[model samples]
Target: MKKVITLTLPGELIFTRLAAQTAASVAALVCGECHPKDNNCEFINAFELAVSEAFTNSALHACQDELPPVTLTFIAERHQLTVTVRDTNEPFGIETPQPDIESYPEGGYGLLIIRKVMDTVTYRRDGDANIISMSKKL
Candidate 1:
Protein backbone atom coordinates (compact mmCIF):
# COMPACT_ATOMS: atom_id res chain seq x y z
CA MET A 1 0.00 0.00 0.00
CA LYS A 2 1.04 3.59 -0.56
CA LYS A 3 0.03 6.74 1.24
CA VAL A 4 0.90 10.43 0.98
CA ILE A 5 0.41 13.61 2.99
CA THR A 6 0.99 17.15 1.80
CA LEU A 7 1.13 20.50 3.53
CA THR A 8 1.69 24.05 2.35
CA LEU A 9 2.67 26.22 5.30
CA PRO A 10 3.62 29.80 5.88
CA GLY A 11 7.32 30.51 5.58
CA GLU A 12 7.99 31.21 9.22
CA LEU A 13 10.06 29.58 11.94
CA ILE A 14 7.04 29.11 14.19
CA PHE A 15 5.40 26.76 11.68
CA THR A 16 8.30 24.34 11.84
CA ARG A 17 6.74 22.52 14.77
CA LEU A 18 3.57 21.85 12.79
CA ALA A 19 5.59 20.24 10.00
CA ALA A 20 7.58 18.25 12.51
CA GLN A 21 4.49 16.91 14.20
CA THR A 22 2.91 15.99 10.91
CA ALA A 23 6.03 14.14 9.83
CA ALA A 24 6.16 12.25 13.12
CA SER A 25 2.56 11.14 12.76
CA VAL A 26 3.09 9.96 9.19
CA ALA A 27 6.25 8.10 10.12
CA ALA A 28 4.59 6.39 13.01
CA LEU A 29 1.58 5.39 10.96
CA VAL A 30 3.70 4.20 8.08
CA CYS A 31 6.57 2.39 9.77
CA GLY A 32 6.47 2.59 13.54
CA GLU A 33 6.29 -1.19 13.73
CA CYS A 34 9.81 -1.45 12.35
CA HIS A 35 11.16 -0.07 15.58
CA PRO A 36 9.44 -2.34 18.05
CA LYS A 37 12.76 -2.87 19.83
CA ASP A 38 13.57 0.80 20.10
CA ASN A 39 12.37 2.21 23.37
CA ASN A 40 13.26 5.84 22.68
CA CYS A 41 11.14 6.07 19.54
CA GLU A 42 14.19 6.43 17.31
CA PHE A 43 12.17 5.88 14.15
CA ILE A 44 9.74 8.66 14.89
CA ASN A 45 12.44 10.99 16.17
CA ALA A 46 14.45 10.78 12.95
CA PHE A 47 11.50 11.78 10.81
CA GLU A 48 10.60 14.62 13.11
CA LEU A 49 14.14 15.93 13.09
CA ALA A 50 14.56 15.67 9.33
CA VAL A 51 11.27 17.33 8.52
CA SER A 52 11.82 20.02 11.08
CA GLU A 53 15.26 20.81 9.76
CA ALA A 54 14.11 20.89 6.14
CA PHE A 55 11.19 23.15 6.92
CA THR A 56 13.35 25.39 9.04
CA ASN A 57 15.79 25.88 6.20
CA SER A 58 13.05 27.00 3.86
CA ALA A 59 11.45 29.20 6.47
CA LEU A 60 14.67 30.83 7.59
CA HIS A 61 16.42 31.27 4.24
CA ALA A 62 14.33 30.33 1.22
CA CYS A 63 12.44 33.58 0.81
CA GLN A 64 15.50 35.84 0.66
CA ASP A 65 13.36 38.97 1.06
CA GLU A 66 9.78 37.91 0.28
CA LEU A 67 7.75 35.37 2.18
CA PRO A 68 6.63 32.53 -0.07
CA PRO A 69 4.82 29.54 1.31
CA VAL A 70 6.66 26.23 1.62
CA THR A 71 5.42 22.84 0.55
CA LEU A 72 6.06 19.49 2.26
CA THR A 73 5.16 16.04 1.10
CA PHE A 74 5.31 12.73 2.96
CA ILE A 75 5.09 9.53 0.93
CA ALA A 76 4.81 6.15 2.61
CA GLU A 77 5.52 3.00 0.71
CA ARG A 78 5.90 -0.64 1.74
CA HIS A 79 9.62 -0.34 2.44
CA GLN A 80 10.37 3.34 2.89
CA LEU A 81 9.10 6.81 3.60
CA THR A 82 10.00 9.85 1.49
CA VAL A 83 9.62 13.48 2.51
CA THR A 84 9.92 16.30 0.04
CA VAL A 85 10.31 19.98 0.96
CA ARG A 86 9.80 22.59 -1.74
CA ASP A 87 10.32 26.33 -1.75
CA THR A 88 10.62 29.31 -4.07
CA ASN A 89 14.24 30.10 -3.35
CA GLU A 90 16.86 30.39 -6.04
CA PRO A 91 18.88 27.27 -6.68
CA PHE A 92 21.52 26.65 -4.04
CA GLY A 93 24.12 24.02 -3.39
CA ILE A 94 23.00 21.09 -1.28
CA GLU A 95 26.50 19.89 -0.47
CA THR A 96 26.72 21.69 2.82
CA PRO A 97 29.98 21.38 4.71
CA GLN A 98 30.05 20.27 8.30
CA PRO A 99 30.19 23.14 10.72
CA ASP A 100 33.30 23.72 12.82
CA ILE A 101 32.53 21.56 15.83
CA GLU A 102 35.39 23.02 17.82
CA SER A 103 33.89 26.51 17.71
CA TYR A 104 30.64 25.31 19.25
CA PRO A 105 28.51 26.97 16.65
CA GLU A 106 24.78 27.04 17.21
CA GLY A 107 23.73 26.59 13.60
CA GLY A 108 24.85 25.48 10.06
CA TYR A 109 24.29 21.79 10.68
CA GLY A 110 20.75 21.27 9.42
CA LEU A 111 21.61 19.68 6.06
CA LEU A 112 24.33 17.56 7.55
CA ILE A 113 22.06 16.18 10.22
CA ILE A 114 19.40 15.47 7.63
CA ARG A 115 21.94 13.57 5.50
CA LYS A 116 23.02 11.52 8.46
CA VAL A 117 19.54 10.44 9.46
CA MET A 118 17.89 9.96 6.09
CA ASP A 119 18.97 7.15 3.77
CA THR A 120 18.54 9.19 0.59
CA VAL A 121 18.58 12.92 -0.10
CA THR A 122 18.26 14.68 -3.43
CA TYR A 123 17.94 18.29 -4.55
CA ARG A 124 16.50 19.64 -7.74
CA ARG A 125 15.31 22.85 -9.30
CA ASP A 126 11.97 22.85 -11.05
CA GLY A 127 11.34 26.22 -12.68
CA ASP A 128 11.09 28.57 -9.71
CA ALA A 129 10.98 25.89 -7.05
CA ASN A 130 13.77 24.33 -5.05
CA ILE A 131 12.95 20.74 -4.21
CA ILE A 132 14.62 18.78 -1.44
CA SER A 133 13.68 15.13 -1.38
CA MET A 134 14.69 12.88 1.53
CA SER A 135 13.85 9.29 2.39
CA LYS A 136 14.59 6.63 4.96
CA LYS A 137 14.27 2.88 4.68
CA LEU A 138 11.63 1.22 6.79
Candidate 2:
Protein backbone atom coordinates (compact mmCIF):
# COMPACT_ATOMS: atom_id res chain seq x y z
CA MET A 1 0.00 0.00 0.00
CA LYS A 2 1.12 3.54 -0.73
CA LYS A 3 0.21 6.66 1.21
CA VAL A 4 0.44 10.26 0.11
CA ILE A 5 -0.07 13.62 1.78
CA THR A 6 -0.09 17.11 0.33
CA LEU A 7 0.22 20.52 1.95
CA THR A 8 0.12 24.03 0.55
CA LEU A 9 1.24 27.18 2.30
CA PRO A 10 2.27 30.73 1.64
CA GLY A 11 5.84 31.13 0.47
CA GLU A 12 6.96 33.41 3.25
CA LEU A 13 9.64 33.17 5.91
CA ILE A 14 7.03 33.40 8.63
CA PHE A 15 5.41 30.16 7.46
CA THR A 16 8.60 28.16 7.14
CA ARG A 17 8.31 26.53 10.54
CA LEU A 18 4.66 25.67 10.01
CA ALA A 19 5.42 24.13 6.65
CA ALA A 20 8.29 22.12 8.09
CA GLN A 21 6.23 20.90 10.99
CA THR A 22 3.37 19.90 8.75
CA ALA A 23 5.66 17.91 6.53
CA ALA A 24 7.31 16.26 9.51
CA SER A 25 4.01 15.33 11.08
CA VAL A 26 2.67 13.82 7.90
CA ALA A 27 5.93 11.94 7.35
CA ALA A 28 5.74 10.47 10.83
CA LEU A 29 2.18 9.36 10.30
CA VAL A 30 3.01 7.75 6.97
CA CYS A 31 6.07 6.04 8.40
CA GLY A 32 4.07 4.67 11.26
CA GLU A 33 1.40 3.40 8.91
CA CYS A 34 3.96 1.71 6.72
CA HIS A 35 5.95 0.14 9.50
CA PRO A 36 3.79 -0.33 12.51
CA LYS A 37 6.07 -2.70 14.40
CA ASP A 38 9.38 -0.85 14.50
CA ASN A 39 10.10 2.70 15.62
CA ASN A 40 12.09 4.24 12.80
CA CYS A 41 13.59 7.13 14.70
CA GLU A 42 16.59 7.66 12.46
CA PHE A 43 14.56 7.57 9.29
CA ILE A 44 12.00 9.93 10.76
CA ASN A 45 14.70 12.33 11.86
CA ALA A 46 16.38 12.38 8.47
CA PHE A 47 13.11 12.87 6.65
CA GLU A 48 12.14 15.74 8.91
CA LEU A 49 15.50 17.43 8.52
CA ALA A 50 15.56 17.10 4.75
CA VAL A 51 11.97 18.23 4.33
CA SER A 52 12.52 21.15 6.70
CA GLU A 53 15.53 22.29 4.72
CA ALA A 54 13.66 22.08 1.47
CA PHE A 55 10.70 24.01 2.89
CA THR A 56 13.00 26.64 4.38
CA ASN A 57 14.87 27.05 1.12
CA SER A 58 11.67 27.49 -0.83
CA ALA A 59 10.24 29.96 1.65
CA LEU A 60 13.43 32.03 1.76
CA HIS A 61 14.62 31.95 -1.85
CA ALA A 62 11.57 31.31 -3.97
CA CYS A 63 9.24 34.15 -3.18
CA GLN A 64 9.49 37.32 -5.24
CA ASP A 65 6.31 39.31 -4.51
CA GLU A 66 2.83 38.62 -3.18
CA LEU A 67 4.13 35.58 -1.36
CA PRO A 68 3.36 32.78 -3.77
CA PRO A 69 2.12 29.43 -2.62
CA VAL A 70 4.43 26.48 -1.99
CA THR A 71 3.24 22.92 -2.31
CA LEU A 72 4.70 19.92 -0.52
CA THR A 73 3.85 16.32 -1.36
CA PHE A 74 4.88 13.31 0.67
CA ILE A 75 4.60 9.79 -0.71
CA ALA A 76 5.35 6.74 1.35
CA GLU A 77 5.76 3.09 0.52
CA ARG A 78 6.81 0.13 2.52
CA HIS A 79 10.51 0.80 2.21
CA GLN A 80 10.84 4.21 0.63
CA LEU A 81 9.55 7.74 1.08
CA THR A 82 9.60 10.58 -1.44
CA VAL A 83 9.06 14.28 -0.81
CA THR A 84 8.46 16.90 -3.48
CA VAL A 85 8.39 20.65 -2.83
CA ARG A 86 7.06 22.97 -5.50
CA ASP A 87 7.23 26.75 -5.63
CA THR A 88 6.20 29.45 -8.05
CA ASN A 89 9.39 31.48 -7.75
CA GLU A 90 11.92 31.76 -10.49
CA PRO A 91 13.90 28.67 -11.12
CA PHE A 92 17.14 28.87 -9.24
CA GLY A 93 19.90 26.50 -10.23
CA ILE A 94 20.85 23.81 -7.78
CA GLU A 95 24.54 23.65 -6.99
CA THR A 96 25.72 21.23 -4.36
CA PRO A 97 28.71 22.75 -2.64
CA GLN A 98 30.80 21.01 -0.08
CA PRO A 99 31.13 23.58 2.63
CA ASP A 100 33.95 23.02 5.04
CA ILE A 101 32.37 22.16 8.36
CA GLU A 102 35.41 23.56 10.15
CA SER A 103 34.85 27.03 8.74
CA TYR A 104 31.38 27.18 10.33
CA PRO A 105 29.65 29.43 7.90
CA GLU A 106 26.55 31.20 9.06
CA GLY A 107 24.44 30.10 6.11
CA GLY A 108 24.58 28.05 2.85
CA TYR A 109 24.42 24.79 4.75
CA GLY A 110 20.77 23.91 4.11
CA LEU A 111 21.30 22.23 0.77
CA LEU A 112 24.39 20.47 2.04
CA ILE A 113 22.59 19.15 5.08
CA ILE A 114 19.62 18.11 2.96
CA ARG A 115 21.79 16.21 0.53
CA LYS A 116 23.66 14.49 3.32
CA VAL A 117 20.50 13.37 5.10
CA MET A 118 18.33 12.27 2.18
CA ASP A 119 19.12 9.19 0.14
CA THR A 120 18.54 11.06 -3.09
CA VAL A 121 18.10 14.78 -3.74
CA THR A 122 17.23 16.48 -7.03
CA TYR A 123 16.03 19.86 -8.24
CA ARG A 124 14.56 20.98 -11.55
CA ARG A 125 12.37 23.56 -13.17
CA ASP A 126 9.04 22.44 -14.58
CA GLY A 127 7.16 25.04 -16.54
CA ASP A 128 6.73 27.94 -14.14
CA ALA A 129 7.43 25.95 -11.02
CA ASN A 130 10.66 25.16 -9.23
CA ILE A 131 10.58 21.62 -7.89
CA ILE A 132 12.82 19.95 -5.35
CA SER A 133 12.56 16.20 -4.86
CA MET A 134 14.06 14.21 -2.01
CA SER A 135 13.80 10.53 -1.14
CA LYS A 136 14.79 8.27 1.70
CA LYS A 137 15.03 4.49 2.04
CA LEU A 138 13.84 2.67 5.10
Candidate 3:
Protein backbone atom coordinates (compact mmCIF):
# COMPACT_ATOMS: atom_id res chain seq x y z
CA MET A 1 0.00 0.00 0.00
CA LYS A 2 0.99 3.56 -0.67
CA LYS A 3 0.34 6.67 1.34
CA VAL A 4 -0.01 10.11 -0.20
CA ILE A 5 -0.01 13.63 1.19
CA THR A 6 -0.76 16.79 -0.75
CA LEU A 7 -0.14 20.32 0.42
CA THR A 8 -0.69 23.63 -1.33
CA LEU A 9 1.18 26.57 0.06
CA PRO A 10 1.28 30.23 -0.88
CA GLY A 11 3.96 30.90 -3.43
CA GLU A 12 6.43 32.72 -1.24
CA LEU A 13 9.89 32.13 0.14
CA ILE A 14 8.74 32.43 3.72
CA PHE A 15 6.51 29.40 3.33
CA THR A 16 9.37 27.14 2.33
CA ARG A 17 9.76 25.97 5.90
CA LEU A 18 6.21 24.67 5.91
CA ALA A 19 6.76 22.71 2.74
CA ALA A 20 10.09 21.36 3.83
CA GLN A 21 8.81 20.34 7.22
CA THR A 22 5.87 18.61 5.65
CA ALA A 23 8.26 16.66 3.45
CA ALA A 24 10.34 15.66 6.41
CA SER A 25 7.28 14.40 8.26
CA VAL A 26 6.24 12.33 5.29
CA ALA A 27 9.73 10.93 5.03
CA ALA A 28 9.67 10.00 8.68
CA LEU A 29 6.37 8.23 8.18
CA VAL A 30 7.78 6.34 5.24
CA CYS A 31 10.84 5.45 7.22
CA GLY A 32 8.57 3.41 9.52
CA GLU A 33 10.88 2.88 12.50
CA CYS A 34 13.62 5.47 12.08
CA HIS A 35 12.13 8.80 13.02
CA PRO A 36 14.36 11.87 13.01
CA LYS A 37 13.15 12.88 16.47
CA ASP A 38 14.58 9.66 17.86
CA ASN A 39 17.52 9.12 15.56
CA ASN A 40 19.02 10.49 12.34
CA CYS A 41 18.17 8.10 9.55
CA GLU A 42 16.94 7.58 6.03
CA PHE A 43 16.57 10.47 3.60
CA ILE A 44 14.67 12.81 5.86
CA ASN A 45 17.29 15.51 5.64
CA ALA A 46 17.71 15.08 1.90
CA PHE A 47 13.97 15.23 1.29
CA GLU A 48 13.66 18.32 3.42
CA LEU A 49 16.45 20.07 1.56
CA ALA A 50 15.18 19.09 -1.87
CA VAL A 51 11.67 20.22 -1.01
CA SER A 52 12.94 23.50 0.37
CA GLU A 53 14.96 24.17 -2.75
CA ALA A 54 12.10 23.26 -5.04
CA PHE A 55 9.64 25.41 -3.16
CA THR A 56 12.06 28.31 -3.05
CA ASN A 57 12.85 28.04 -6.74
CA SER A 58 9.20 28.00 -7.68
CA ALA A 59 8.36 30.91 -5.43
CA LEU A 60 11.17 32.97 -6.89
CA HIS A 61 10.66 32.13 -10.57
CA ALA A 62 7.07 31.06 -10.95
CA CYS A 63 4.79 33.81 -9.75
CA GLN A 64 4.44 36.16 -12.70
CA ASP A 65 1.23 37.89 -11.71
CA GLU A 66 -0.48 37.72 -8.34
CA LEU A 67 1.16 35.31 -5.92
CA PRO A 68 0.32 31.79 -6.95
CA PRO A 69 0.36 28.55 -5.02
CA VAL A 70 2.92 25.78 -5.05
CA THR A 71 1.53 22.30 -4.58
CA LEU A 72 3.61 19.56 -3.03
CA THR A 73 2.56 15.96 -3.42
CA PHE A 74 4.26 13.17 -1.55
CA ILE A 75 3.75 9.56 -2.50
CA ALA A 76 5.17 6.97 -0.17
CA GLU A 77 5.45 3.42 -1.35
CA ARG A 78 6.82 0.28 0.21
CA HIS A 79 10.38 1.01 -0.81
CA GLN A 80 10.41 4.62 -2.00
CA LEU A 81 9.16 8.10 -1.40
CA THR A 82 8.50 10.54 -4.25
CA VAL A 83 7.75 14.21 -4.01
CA THR A 84 6.36 16.36 -6.78
CA VAL A 85 6.38 20.10 -6.60
CA ARG A 86 3.86 21.66 -8.95
CA ASP A 87 3.85 25.27 -10.04
CA THR A 88 2.49 27.47 -12.75
CA ASN A 89 5.82 28.56 -14.17
CA GLU A 90 7.50 28.72 -17.50
CA PRO A 91 9.25 25.59 -18.60
CA PHE A 92 12.99 25.19 -18.19
CA GLY A 93 15.50 22.55 -19.09
CA ILE A 94 15.92 19.95 -16.36
CA GLU A 95 19.37 18.85 -17.52
CA THR A 96 21.05 22.15 -16.78
CA PRO A 97 24.76 21.72 -16.34
CA GLN A 98 26.18 22.00 -12.85
CA PRO A 99 27.73 25.28 -11.89
CA ASP A 100 31.52 25.54 -11.93
CA ILE A 101 33.08 24.94 -8.55
CA GLU A 102 36.34 26.89 -8.95
CA SER A 103 34.73 30.31 -9.35
CA TYR A 104 32.57 29.62 -6.28
CA PRO A 105 29.30 30.95 -7.56
CA GLU A 106 26.95 32.42 -5.04
CA GLY A 107 23.83 30.81 -6.49
CA GLY A 108 22.75 28.40 -9.26
CA TYR A 109 23.11 25.39 -7.02
CA GLY A 110 19.44 24.61 -6.31
CA LEU A 111 19.10 21.93 -8.96
CA LEU A 112 22.52 20.55 -8.20
CA ILE A 113 21.69 20.11 -4.54
CA ILE A 114 18.38 18.51 -5.37
CA ARG A 115 19.97 16.06 -7.77
CA LYS A 116 22.64 15.14 -5.29
CA VAL A 117 20.22 14.58 -2.45
CA MET A 118 17.46 12.72 -4.24
CA ASP A 119 17.89 9.34 -5.87
CA THR A 120 16.14 10.59 -9.00
CA VAL A 121 15.13 14.05 -10.14
CA THR A 122 12.98 15.05 -13.09
CA TYR A 123 11.22 18.08 -14.50
CA ARG A 124 8.48 18.42 -17.04
CA ARG A 125 5.94 20.88 -18.31
CA ASP A 126 2.46 19.55 -17.83
CA GLY A 127 0.07 21.67 -19.86
CA ASP A 128 0.04 24.96 -17.95
CA ALA A 129 1.92 23.65 -14.94
CA ASN A 130 5.55 22.80 -14.38
CA ILE A 131 6.40 19.82 -12.22
CA ILE A 132 9.61 18.76 -10.54
CA SER A 133 9.49 15.26 -9.16
CA MET A 134 12.18 13.79 -6.91
CA SER A 135 12.30 10.28 -5.58
CA LYS A 136 14.43 8.44 -3.04
CA LYS A 137 14.61 4.81 -2.06
CA LEU A 138 13.75 3.86 1.50
Best by TM-score: 3
lDDT of 3 by residue, 1-138 (tens): 988889998898889998988888888888877675544664888888999999999999865577788999999999999999999887777787899999999988989999999999989899989999999998
TM-score of each: 0.90, 0.86, 0.93
Worst 10 residues of 2 by lDDT: 31-40
Off by over 4 Å in 3: none
lDDT of 2 by residue, 47-101 (tens): 7778778877877776476788889988888888898999988778779577777
Clashes of each: 0, 0, 0
The residue-by-residue lDDT of candidate 1 on 10-37, one tens digit each, is 8889999999988888888887574433
Please report the TM-score between candidate 1 and the true structure.
Answer: 0.90
Q: What are the clashing pairs of model 1?
A: none
Candidate 1 regions off by >4 Å?
34-39, 64-66
Sort by TM-score, best first: 3, 1, 2
What C-alpha RMSD separates each model from the true structure? 2.6, 3.0, 1.5
lDDT of 2: 0.79
